[model samples]
Target: MQVQVKLFAFFREGRFIKEDKELPTDTTAGQVIDDLNIDREEVGVLMLNSRHCKFDTVLQEGDIYAIFPVIGGG
Candidate 1:
């Protein structure tokens, strides 16, 4: 399956860039994230089809998933 993976904030500065990930049919959102070796706290949100979902959410092929970093305000 072809899933689009995105990285934001400092993650983008690390070992991440625009790329496509391949996984089994039952792959969860969390698995893909972990494969990137990204720090969990660094991610603020996970959106699939514009709706926010948890990492356990099962990823569907051809879905436009966006992972953004946590934004903090003083």
Candidate 2:
């Protein structure tokens, strides 16, 4: 199955801003992060199809997934 992945903020460093990725069925958001060598602790948000989701959220074919890194400000 294919899914659209969008990386935000520092998450796009050395990576792509957005791209269509070929993934296995039932792949979890966490799995994709792991595959990209992203640290779970650094992940600030996960969105599936524009809705807030978790790392364990299962990704479906043609789904749009977005990842954001923790942002700090005062």
Candidate 3:
């Protein structure tokens, strides 16, 4: 399946802002994060097609999956 992955904040430091990924069937959101070497604890929000989702969320073809880093503020 092909899914569009978007990274926000520090998550895009050494990675792209957005890209289309070719993944196997049944691939979860966490799996993609692992592949990108992103720590689960650093994840602030997970979105699938603009809706909040979880790490175990199953991704589908043409899905727009976004990952945001935990925001830190004063």
Error of 1 at 15 (Å): 2.5
Task: Write one digit per residue (lDDT tens) for candidate 2, span 1-74.
Answer: 99999999998999999999999899999999999999999999899999999999999999999999987789
Per-residue lDDT tens digits for candidate 3, residues 1-74, read 99999999989999999999999999999999999999999999999999999999999989999999887679
Please, what is the TM-score per model?
0.83, 0.94, 0.94
Write candidate 1's Cα lDDT for 1-74 as tens digits: 88888776777886676678777988888887787787777779988878998889999888777788887779
RMSD of 2: 1.4
Which residue runs does candidate 3 get wrong by more than 4 Å? 72-74
Model 2, residue 66: distance off in Å is 0.3
Give, for candidate 3, the lowest lDDT window spanning 10 residues.
65-74
Q: How accurate is candidate 1 locally (lDDT)?
A: 0.81
